[model samples]
Target: MATTPDTPVAKALRRELLLVTGMSGAGRSTVGNALEDLGWYVVDNLPPQMLRPLVDLSRHTGDSIPRVAAVVDIRGGRLFADVQAALESLRDTDDTRLLFLDATDAVLVRRFENVRRPHPLQGDGTLLDGISAERARMAELRSQADIVIDTSELNIHQLATLVQEQFAEEDEPTTRVTVLSFGYKYGLPSDADHVADCRFLPNPFWVPELKELTGLDDVVADYVLGLPGAGEFIDGYVAALRPVFDGYGRENKRHATIALGCTGGKHRSVAIAEELGRRLSALPGIAVSVKHRDLGRE
Candidate 1:
């Protein structure tokens, strides 16, 4: 049935379309649930061609289903190619937005292994091969996304919290920066956007009394922050990030990871990461969180 343009249902459904997509193990399912928690009508694995009709269904269903979010990914195989054409119909309007979720290759592989499932496109090849194929195919979609989240270090709860933070309010999405602390021996955090070393500070491990203590302890933190040049580095690094944040804004990147490393994550790096987190949190429109990636590994 053709409905009048002014119908209450049609008017209620005039909001933007939110398309959730990304890597196979990149938490698309979690994001969909997060959207549902935010009161959105979420559809999973929706075929690209049915997108417009889905909207029409909402438009004709009265105000019961005003906002809609769809999770589309590689599971649709060849049909995924039609997504470009499907998106073209919505491009003329400002009502279409895409949210892309991604994680480092290592993280994605780990996720798949943890679930004991093969990659959707893996076939008879190695896990890496399937991941490579999926990334290549999804490249264009990723580039077109309005929001890109790197989930390399996030747990499901954290990811859900982040999704809620971005979509909970209509005002504006807040940029979140994660300051991660790690030990050099453990290798760099694969997802870090910025990295700084705190090894210049003398190791507290040699200072018998502080050996067993971590940066969270007041004494360990005080010792690290009181060292020569510690305060200077923190100030300068925070200052330098201003231009970086500006660049991110221009590029519309809402998430960033900064890694600080030391000989061991137990002391200096952890202390520095906390300081950086505190400083970065004070910045306007930006939220900051700190994590000690290798804190207790020793």
Candidate 2:
């Protein structure tokens, strides 16, 4: 009863496989570095066609490399075009998951400009044009991604932190929750699965004493939480989310983004988001992290 290389039993020997891909400037390197720090065997610029062989190698190595992560991108040219088929080939083998890194076109362009290098697909066209073309090419893969991280507003440290949160350990939680605080004036967070508005609470911006302080400050957090109905909202929201979290767990959804917004994103939203993150973190089998998207934009 020898199982073939492509058989389910053979694939099950490799416990974890992460295929990291996405836009050129969307922090793939950061993800790879973070995964490496977590003791994952990370292979950079791996062609899609090699995915199965990589998994087989990991299985062959036994306990030497329990987790394997491959970084695949447009740099492989036509070889990259085989990703979807490669992914399908690995569907039943191991805990294979795809992590797609993304950022807005403007942000991608800015990143490329900062590095003073043209996009791989840029050719003679502008940076924005290259980004657009890449996006178009990645559209299908993005749609099939198990997790899509938008790094438009995230700094390098923040992006690294996110990667660590998602894949820091082998015994990580089943679901990872990110409580993001943003500003309504800055447009909604594109990756938010659920959004709550803290504008109904008093505006801390008008309070001269707390105007400059962020939600991370004890004084500002106290002021924001002291408002009427603030506590009720937090409690009710957490209670309502109990079933939602259960549903997500049952559906095998590993990530959820809860975005909280206020007028300026400096005070109310940030405070509420922190409180919500605190409460959500207490839920069993859930990993929570908070990000103040527009904390210092003003």
Candidate 3:
């Protein structure tokens, strides 16, 4: 048998092959859209067995499809098991990466309810029942994932921004940070790697004038940041996170979520998160964005 030398198309295929899989309602579509926006050739609901054929076809197309992302899920039923084997085989010849999207059971349930659709695995049982079964089946894959994003607290735009941050052109920063402001009453963000409580600062909600304004307003922002220990806490927290950020770089973690919580997300937490974001953005080699998860929930 004659051995064929590697060609340009084969070299290109070996550079980028991403397998996107996760919870049914965890925003795989959003991820696909974002990846497309960033120049990825996306294939939706592709069965595992078809992956190799797709790559082979892409090779024929040359550089037109430089990067390829395939969205795979449990919807394939029994064939889902083949995904693991396919992934293992690709690892030998490709720079394969698996990205897993996840959210809490509560969030998934709410999303399913909003869409008025039954879980693929629900059968005759409740939504939670299906969620439980799916999670059990996906346990191994999740553990094997190179990147895992928890979308429990993310809105559509926030999730899209995350995908863009992770998949955008190579010139961007290596690590992107999301500084999230959320209300304690609304529950902590499940995806947050670090959380800070802003309750120690005075509640602006009680201040009649500031109550009407959000942290985006200078008056509210000044009030929150002027409190004793406020500036010091932000500075200290940033300093403390320096090593954490360094570690993330060393470990090749591309994204990190830092959540700040107060009684309500409208005032204290939002102000703090903004200031933190501003400060972090100034640091070299890091990109930061701020989001108020419960800003209008009042």
Taken over the whole model, the C-alpha lDDT of each candidate is 0.87, 0.89, 0.89
RMSD, every candidate, angstroms: 13.1, 13.6, 13.1
Candidate of highest lDDT: 2
| lDDT at 193, model 1 | 94
| Residue 118 error, candidate 3, Å | 0.5
Q: Over 4 Å off in model 1, which ranges? A: 1-13, 170-298
Candidate 1, residues 1-298, lDDT tens digits: the string is 5657689666545665799999989999889987876678999999898898887787778778767898888898888889988887876653778899999899999999999999999999988999999999999999999999999998877788788778865534346789999999989889999999999999999999999999999999999999999999999999999889866654446689999999878899999999889999888767788999999997
TM-score of each: 0.53, 0.54, 0.54
lDDT of 3 by residue, 173-241 (tens): 657899999999999999999999999998999999988899999999999999999999999999999
Cα error of candidate 1 at position 81, Å? 1.1
- Model 3, TM vs. native: 0.54
Candidate 2 residue runs with Cα over 4 Å from true position: 1-14, 170-298
User: Is candidate 1 or 2 superior in TM-score?
Assistant: 2
Please give the range of 10 consecutive residues that has the lowest summed lDDT in model 2.
246-255
| Clashing residue pair totals per candidate (backbone < 3 A) | 0, 0, 0
